[model samples]
Target chain A: MKKTINIPLGSQHISLLEPVRFKFECENEKIISVDSDVGFVHRGIERACTTKFKFDAIGYVVARVCGLCAITHSLSYTAAVEKLLGGEITKKAKYLRILLLELDRIHSHMLCLSHTCENAGFEAMFMRIMGDRELVMEIQELLTGNRVQFDYINIGGVNRDINSEVAKKIIENLYEVKQRVLGYMDEFTNNWSLSLKFKGIGALSLDDAYMFNAIGPLARASGLNIDVRNEIDYLPFNEVGFAMQTQSEGDINARNIVRLHEILNSILMCENVLSGLPEGAIFTKLKGKPNGEAIVRFEAPRGELMYYVKGNGSAMLERVRIKTPTFASIPVFSHIFVGENYADAPAILASFDPCLSCTAK
Target chain B: MFDLKKYRKKSPWILHYNAGSCNGCDIEILASLSPKYDLERFGVINTGNPKQSDIFLVTGPVTYRSRERLIELYTQMPEPKVVVAVGSCTCTGGVFRDMYNVEDGIDRYIPVDVYIAGCAVSPELIIDGVVKALDILEKKSKEMEKPLKLFKEAISENGVVNRRNVALKVGEVHEEN
Candidate 1:
């Protein structure tokens, strides 16, 4: 007997919350070949940033492109623009950014982790994880005055500064959150149901992950050492005691565990940064216009987020190019989706936390 | 009576969809699942596929580009489905209401059974909205009425059995009462 199975999904497929198309050739419900097309919501964010939006205002808009990964966009853009202007954010501000950025990491990982639950048929566990994620979002609102598009970081420094009282509250919250989050790890880590669902699922062999040049968690999960925070060695961040989490298998379960473990590390890093935060001017006014090309990389919640900025000594940036982790991981997404059950497609995709808005921009 | 109280105890899985908007609601929606508010105790889950989902939690105002696709996905979902508009953007188009690109709200394109209000909604409200959606779903599952039909006629108006926009919208409108 001979047969053919075609599963055509749109940039607007049910599994994909955002716009991205994938057509899978399946054999007995297992995906055999896969293809995709993006750009459904490509708003020309870079074009608007370089041409229309003011340099300072662009940060807010960049962050808005994808709420899930906004911090990566804003921070990477700031790093690139700051480099072009030969500006360095105060050590205090750098530390603060890390705090906000890591808070972002905590919330994002919680989301991906919880979604993993839903994907694996552990609906109860998904709800449990989501319940715990609220503290992080509440902290974000309290600190930045906004939840998603924080608009905290500017060209030089952050818009908001944390006071000792707020800092204390954050610390208390982090400690409590740490205990609470850790409490759930056994369910996430040891539960046989989740382990069965995720273990060995969506295996991106080290060679395949590297061949596709995957970055961030996708790469890290594959046992690749490529965290941009460590790569560029940003101040305080580099000094702060932290380590990257990775897994050798590069399967879905490994990705989940790596993220779950990394969240603990992220919490400690935030606590340390806040505890020893130096008091100083939150921002330094930049004097001259941006005049040259510069590249900046920041470790976003996803992975290594890179921004390229070209300036012409004017208020307007000449060109802005963002190489988001999701964009870098497209080849990897396609590569891993093959041979997986059609049902597992959504789980594998969500495992990467593919932010289409970030990629489209 | 298929006790709604019992049904409420077992909240169904939800699938999140972003038609288009600023991501304020999207993030907060995700936050409801995190450690603090923890909607999981209520049994609400975010599913990636429409097949397994009992409710559709959407954020952002629908855009022209996303209108058809959203409807198509709605059609593909198995019945006994509830649509929850979970943000100001999805509810009323929010700040993007003025944009030429937006459809104003997901309700403009699809039937929204429940609304969770927020500039980006708070996690509390997200939980509340999910509970409301479950009630609606419970009441719905007990009824034998066909789904609401939003569109009067398919654009082509061909002599075909189908007059719906997409799979989800197939019988999702009420004939003029």
Candidate 2:
């Protein structure tokens, strides 16, 4: 008889922020097989996007897909619509969009780092990261007029423009955030207990990462060169100083390190955007309906978020398919869970930062 | 013997479940527990075990697959528990109202004591809702602790009180004139 027992985690658990269930087949301590159910948070957002809301309103509706990456969702959708309508937004609008997107990434990465610490039993570090995360949130609220779900991006361009006072405030806050991130970098690299919990634990190799087509920080951590920011030209990422951060270990520690470096890079990009902002109007009135199918991909906090919008020269869209990052990385997530200890499951899950809402939506 | 009820009222451990809403309210709830909002100051802790919790904080609009688990968690909790529905979608299905897979709100299946409304409710509102749920939890605990009246009233034809009615009010402490 096979002496394996099954342990189920989540759908509703302390470690997970959303609803996702995993059944792990374990022999004593090591997990040998894994199965996951990620449909608990699926609310038919795709179906509703076509039937319930019009094209203009769908920008905000899709933002509800995942609050942590709301800006990315709306930005991709708006970019797709602009592509369809043949509208050319101003350079200033493009820069502002990148600014908000990078700021969102900073706060989101902080949330993931803090959550990883909390799951690994480092309560103090968890509190410290979370407390510092508020600084990014403060800047976000200042720029977008909302903390979590900012419907700042519109069809032609962005909704809000930054004034000099707000710009000054952003630069000051980013400086403070940079200092804090440097301290965290030192701690994450040096702390003995954190290293023990993260290093060589729940690791995925470079081959496995490539085979699974892993994207975002998960791919970057495994030493795979895949970042939508580098590939896409919808946003001027290169001009505003976007760099791809990667690591070789591909473990929880490597993932954290990748996220921290990305945070620093994003902060640099935000500073660059504020200093080199072009002079133009934020919003442009595009006078036409989107009449073709267009696919737009942008980097969400987790990975590459793709939006496929089909329009038939009308107000109501034909189809709005959102391929969220978490949905694509499920295979990679399950692959990493196998051969890991059942007790380290929560920490591993937190490290992946699985957004079931994005997966299910 | 230690007073479990008093301890529960003072330091209510919370069980958070995401049925189907966007993650806005979920993150806000996490933010409230963090240092800035610091809901832990109120003796509230987010726990994984349903049985060990007194206050249940649920986010999402209650999707099809999550309905069973939502009820399972609600039933597994001990008596005198309070359920707080966080977010506009969880309250009344906000933007996802007509979505095919959603069941509108959690109240459709489970009873809700407090509802925090917002596209994604802010941390301040979530803290208020949890504090409000604490009061409701204390009331329910008191209601559970009261002694049974059990006395039989007159069965006069004018206004007779039946056994069924008396059984319904068995443990309730009615106010006397």
Candidate 3:
């Protein structure tokens, strides 16, 4: 007899924020094998993009794919459309785009950090971080008018421009958030449950990370220095103070530290964008429908988010394919669950920050 | 004796199920429970178990595969419970109305008492929606007690009135007499 009992984790579980199911074959407390289903949140957005909506409107449609990384979805689609149409947006628009993108990343990472703490059974830390995350949400709402689904990026350029008062407010909030993140850095490094308990659990070796083709913080945590922000020159991430944060442990602790450091780096990038914003018109009014195929990659809060858009010079696009980071990370998630205690499953899953909505969409 | 009504109003545990909406509404729900919004001040806790929960806070337009689990959780919830549909997609399928894999809205599967509509419902709106759910929950509890009250009335009338009088009132008993 195998002497293994199967435990299903989700589809409607409290530990999960989205609908993802994980079936773990456990022998006593140790998990022997893991099976996961990631399609519960699929709403057929990709097919709708090609058949129902036009190329111009797909930017807004794709933003609904996942509210956490809405800005990245719209940005990648807009960039691909711009590529297909062969148009150049003004530098000011690009700066505004980066500002919003970085703001989105800061909040998403904070949410993930809070969730990890919650799974660790540190309820107070979860509450404290969640309360502090409101600072980033405030600035995001101040800049884009909406907290979650920004829908700020469009094909030609960004829809809104930043004024001095708004910039001052954003800068103030970012400064406050930076201070709070520093405090969290101390807590994450020194705390027993968050730091020590997470050190060696659910670890992925560097060789396994490479073999699994891990992206985003998951790969970066395992000493793989691959970041979409560093690879793509379309957006001026290098001009800003964007640095790749990496760690060697590749466990829950390293992932948390990488995310915290990334939050700090993202805040610096937002400040740089505000200070060095170029003077130009925000929108260029690119004319004509997209007639070519284009692929654009962006660094979402989770990892690399790529969009494939094909247009036939008609009102509707022929195809709108999305490659979400969470969808790509399912392999790494399944691989990491084996040989770990079943009790640590939720905390480890939270550390990966699997965005199921993005994966299914 | 345990007063289910009084305690149900004071502390209504929430069971959140993501039927398949984007994660915007789900995070807002969490934020509302956190310190700033402080929905927990009203004694609402998000629990994983369905049996102990009073409010079913469901987000998302029903996806193809998730509809079964959505109903399973709904049926597992005890009687006199309230269902709050958060986000526009969960209410009327919002942007994903005509999507192939989705079944439009959650109302097609589960009965919704409160519908909070926003692409991504804000924390303030989520708080408002939950407050409204508390009222509906209280009302449903009252209704659940109605049948017992009627049955008690019939037994009491059997002693107070004659057989003929009780028989005459039998027709009226079917009504809310």
Write model 1 residue lDDT over A111-156, tens digit each, in one string: 8887767766676787677776767766888898877667788988
TM-score of chain B as predicted in candidate 3: 0.87
Ranked by DockQ, the better of candidates 2 and 3 is 3
- On residues A218-296, what C-alpha lDDT tens digit does candidate 2 reach at each position? 9999999888899989889999898889999999999999999999999999999998999989888998888989999
Top-TM-score candidate index: 3
Fnat of candidate 2: 0.91
Model 2 Cα lDDT, one tens digit per residue, B1-177: 898866887899999988887889889999999999999999998898999998989988888899999999999998889999998888898898978998888888889999998877889999999999999999998888877565545355658645544343434545420
Ranked by TM-score from best down, the candidates are 3, 2, 1
Which pairs of residues have clashing backbones in candidate 2?
Answer: B21-B60
Candidate 3 residue-wise lDDT at B59: 90
Model 2 stretches astray by more than 4 angstroms: B151-177
Taking all chains together, each candidate's TM-score versus the true structure is 0.79, 0.95, 0.96
Query: What's the distance in Å from true for residue A16, model 1?
Result: 4.3
TM-score of chain A of 3: 0.99
